[model samples]
Target: MRAVLLFAVFVALLAATAVFAYYGLAGPEEVALGVHGWTAMIIGVIFSILVGVGLMGLMFFSSRHGYDEPPQVRKDR
Candidate 1:
């Protein structure tokens, strides 16, 4: 549930960012940097979704495989 909530929030933020990026809210001068307004926005959104999902999958895999562990060892002196 928490993961789903987090993913939703992340996607929403990415969508907002893409909208801003596409509408030239930053400025028209930025368009020449690479992608144009709408194109750049769409690309940004897609990239965000891909990267976010990829990372989540990686984390899930690591957790499932028990790759995450504390380095500290317990001992009786």
Candidate 2:
């Protein structure tokens, strides 16, 4: 029942957002090519940097915490 309720709510919100986005970007004003290109490039570069930083952080943390080490073998079976 809870999951069904959640699904219903998600569907409703999805429909609402679809309507909102359609109306929001349906304007007749033409966006410049340079503006679009720069925006996309900036977003892409930022995303790449964020991903690299997160990857390096995770690698450093795991190495320091010994998460990359193999587990001890059990010989007393």
Q: In terms of TM-score, which candidate is strongest?
A: 2
| RMSD to true structure for each model, in Å | 9.2, 7.6
Give candidate 1's error at residue 51 in angstroms: 0.9
Q: Give per-model TM-scores.
A: 0.47, 0.56
Candidate 1 lDDT tens digits, 1-77: 99999999999999999998877656676445544766888999999999999999999999998888667776976
How accurate locally, in lDDT, is each candidate? 0.86, 0.91
lDDT of 1 at 74: 69
Residue 10 C-alpha lDDT in model 1: 100
lDDT of 2 by residue, 1-77 (tens): 99999999999999999999887767455753477898998999999999999999999999999999999999999
Off by over 4 Å in 2: 1-33
How does residue 71 of candidate 1 score in lDDT?
71
